[model samples]
Target: MKRLHYFMIVFLITGISYAQELTITGMVTEDGTGTPLPYVNVTVKRTSNTTNTDFDGNYSIKVNLGDTLSFSYVGYESEEIKVKKNDSVINVTMSIAPGTLEEVVVTAYGARKAKKSLGYVVSAVSSESISMSRSERRKARRASKKSNKSLNKALSGKVAGLTISNGVGYTNSNSSVKIRGANSVSGAQQPLYIIDGIPVNKKDIAKIQHIDPTKISDVKVLKDKKATSLYGFRAIHGCIIITTHKGNYEIKNNESYEEIVENSFEKVRTSPLSTFSIDVDKASYSNVRRMINNGQQIPADAVKIEEMINYFEYDYKQPKGDHPFAIHTEYGKTPWNKETQLVKIGLKGKEIPQDEIPASNLVFLLDVSGSMDQANKLPLLKRAFKLLVNQLREKDKVSIVVYAGAAGMVLKPTSGINKNEINQALDNLDAGGSTAGGAGIELAYKIAQKNFIKNGNNRVILATDGDFNVGMSSDKDMKTLIEEKRKSGVFLTCLGFGMNNYKDSKLETLADKGNGNHAYIDTMQEAQRVLGKEFGGTLYTIAKDVKIQVEFNPAKVQAYRLIGYENRLLADEDFVDDTKDAGELGSGHTVTALYEVIPVGVRSEYINEIPDLKYTNSEINRNFGDELLTVKFRYKRPQESKSIEMIHILKTGENKVSKDFSFAASVAWFGMKIRKSKYINNDQIKDIVTLAEENRAADNQGYRAEFVRLMNSYQTL
Candidate 1:
């Protein structure tokens, strides 16, 4: 007891001494522009302490007196300072240090290289203009507001073929920035944005309204095939590479927020149950379509086989009883590999007619910041809303809300019948100021609640480039706020428009968490397809919190792998947890998922064989008898808390392949080909085209024909 007391006393003294040390906090900015640089590496030289700047370019670190500190950033000279006993603040201003080999320029993934080495056509706007020193950035920020200056105006005519149009954006940021021209049919034409080695979407940029223009160290555009080939399909439309100022300290983020988990084949004996959230979102398909249409190769990571298969409607019977959706399952020989089998699970929501659908209480949350001034942004949004307004009945109500520097209600909850009033209000909205997306969401939700319709559809239709640059811009905060707002029975519909910095990932999260659907409107036709042709399907939710689980038979299957749905993959325990949220299904919406299974006698190089366990040599149960797998589904009605369950089983038999099934297989095959998947052994693009052509049924919408054209375009490339 005496020893323990002595140790405790010593520990207390040490803790107190450590606590007395000073913590230094400061903003790291470019030396000349005073623009804060994010992700700057700051480290206490000899000590292990280190930290990176946040999005705001601010950092805080704890250090003792006499501790030497080092600050460093890419493309900038390194600096070191010694901490004084009384020091509480240490602001750093780093100087530019371009790469040594030839004239250097920042490129995709924050790579700095000599321009002469690149074989592609490259253009660069350096720190001298894009991001000056701290003081210059402030002056630029103020001047931009005074003159209503934007990224588009500043960059116009600077790069030979680059075109930046006035569109929805923060007053402090650029409008829609496009390089060269549109090469993709469905993919965004804007260059992918990279800041401090992070690929940020337009919405990510929009969330921060006060970014110092000088923080943008350099902006480079890769126009030729050779320059963008490294980036895969995402760069096919052209690549706009950006490098932001950051510290050079050794920072650590072992667990990145946006990391993708690569799916691996699971051994049935070790883990037989495969569980995942049902993903009804088709954004992946549209995004990939954009890339393919642009004549760019598709990024392997972007090719979600599930979304691609689900993008097109499949012919399945509607649910007969109390359930809102029907579940269908089939097993067949794998088209890609004869040794393996393919398992498909499909769900079809009940279709509801316009007359039978509930009246809607819609809050049109329009983003009218300077970035949205482009013809494709606010103008297109106005036209899209008009199409939706035209669908509204006398019983439906609508409200107009616009957000820029602030959020405000432009039109009160007026009858949808008053189309003229809504149109007028929409026309009056002009672009300027910063983006206050959080504020706009709050006000819109408040208005939606004030005029709550107990049994009607209350929803917020947010149309923007997904750029929010004011308060509550962080993804975590935005997600929490949206999740909270969804409890008010107000669903969300995110309509992404324009390009250059488009936040496809952010919008996807908003839609998934808000119990809504997300669609990118690249043209008027897409708007018509989403808001017009699929009105009931896009707006009305038939089933919510949908989850799917499949149990593979160890006796018949060696290993299995699910294709795509990486973000939607869930733990087995989550399948039965009603409190967890999953994807939603709208009226008449169809969802499909596919799995590749290695048969018992087949040897798949993709499957890793684990050595026998040390403890239990569990025997494989063979009682199931030729059963391939048992699929179970769980879903809840839109407003329900509990969930209903359904099950289906598959067995080994002579494969019965239909035209629809073959078409789905062809689509999957095409996706794999574009992705250049290592798992696609012996599959060829010609085979995919042949299968698609042979299975192309009554091509009414010409969708299959368009796909054929896209496939043909890819073949040429």
Candidate 2:
């Protein structure tokens, strides 16, 4: 009986010990601020069990009684706490790194690797060091908030070969961050920002201002191919890895994403008279180039061949007459398939010198919502606008309007010469709350109309990620609103900044209906190109409602395919309707289009068979004999309602191809290769690279050379 009692007591003791091995759950945060720190590495000393804090800084792990748990975060002092018998939650507060020690660097895909093991150069700045720097700068500028110091500006002189520029919005959060130099011409040049092992998109990064800088532990910049290769295509732009303080509970605030709606290819025989609005926007081209260079297959919907072709500058003849644009046409054998002939259509808008340009009345409609908290959005936007401000003359005037859950005028009708006031107002702007884009648009138009300059440049430059969730957010609603607003004679220029949950479709619609142009600003260089180099072209509308209608001759062609401009296609009757909305062309803008035509005698698999028409058939028109196609263009003056018409007929001539043609063809071929289009069977990356190299002209600015390098980069991938 005594032996049985001893065994029972031992069994009870073992069961109690087993039950004590429970899990601990809690958050780690800054000691005083209570700000959650993410990416805090939690581990059990001498054990393999480990875990990381989520975005909310929440973490959970299992432990037995008396087990020691260690919490370590870069730039933060390490802490250890013993697990008690009944302890279910143990929160830790980590301070800045104490003394000179080996710093831990987070690399590709959130993998924490020792800085010493990394072969490539990685510039890392500890939060404590930044704090010291900020403290000194704060003493110098006692009037300003220490939190306002932009990440770009904060790290300016700290990193080697890293260039930081101002971003688009109000705060310093959206500042442009670049690593090393530009490797891809068409891809995003800004480095990828990873917060606490989570890859934060440009959109969310804009709102990073909400993240307490004090909660940050360290910022590491990954430069070199090996360091960034793990991120795949996104790493082509390099990467900025940041580990913040830890805490508990996941914060699920950011939920932004995007997908393009693709336009389907059409049959020429069924639709001989192809009509489409002339698209001068080059966003699609740059976007596609980004995808390709990132080692990604370009989304078919994102492949706009017309935009790609129009991206490069062509040696088209300038307009000699009173017309706003000149028409240039050429016929050559298709580079991809020799069996088909390609017809190129080019339109060169009359270039007006800056002195000749009209006085500008500009309103900057900025989105300062929570989404605009990154260093690349609002901050970069502000920098971009500053560049434009520097370009403005005394005659030009500017106003600032912002939206985020509400719309308000920040800077009222300030003259270009009063740059100090404008700069001050820009600096005073802050970001928070939800996006109220529609309300901002309405208010901006009202301001623009109040200060409307007749026959002058009156435009609202909207800078945002187009994350309109709060008010009037639907595409249909936004399109309708823009359509109604365009009647005010105020053109719109939508400058997209940041990525991840970017509403590309919404922005495109706004620009399409608002009688304006759309461009994506991925880097400060792009900002300089859009708002500085092409300032006149970007802001001044040379022609409006521009439409292109091409009538292919059945006698000369069996079947034809329009290379791109699928989204711009219009009804055949819409071409003659002056009331119908089309596309707008800016000063000095160039638009190009290509059509692959199958000769009557050639047999191609792309040609679809159709039953003979019982009532009407596409009969040969002898009057247009030997003429391949007739291209008709109609456009109106910026302020005019009626369109002026122009026409060009492509006739049988020498199949001679110029460097411009070859270069444009090469770009198109590269785009197709990236898209893996149904028609890309004969396409080869090597051939595209060769064509680009052979046709590269005197690249005074090295743009062509950059493009060649990009093509080579794609080939290697």
Off by over 4 Å in 2: 1-270, 289-298, 715-717
Compared with the true structure, all predictions reach lDDT values of: 0.76, 0.78
Worst 10 residues of 1 by lDDT: 248-257
What tens-digit string does per-residue lDDT give for candidate 2 at 530-561?
Answer: 89989988999899999999988877888777
Q: Which residue ranges in model 1 land beyond 4 Å of their true spot?
A: 1-259, 296-301, 614-617
Per-candidate RMSD vs. true structure?
Answer: 24.7, 22.5
lDDT of 1 at 606: 77
Model 1, 654-680: lDDT tens digits are: 778767787888888888776676777
Q: Residue 34 CA error for candidate 1 (Å)? A: 59
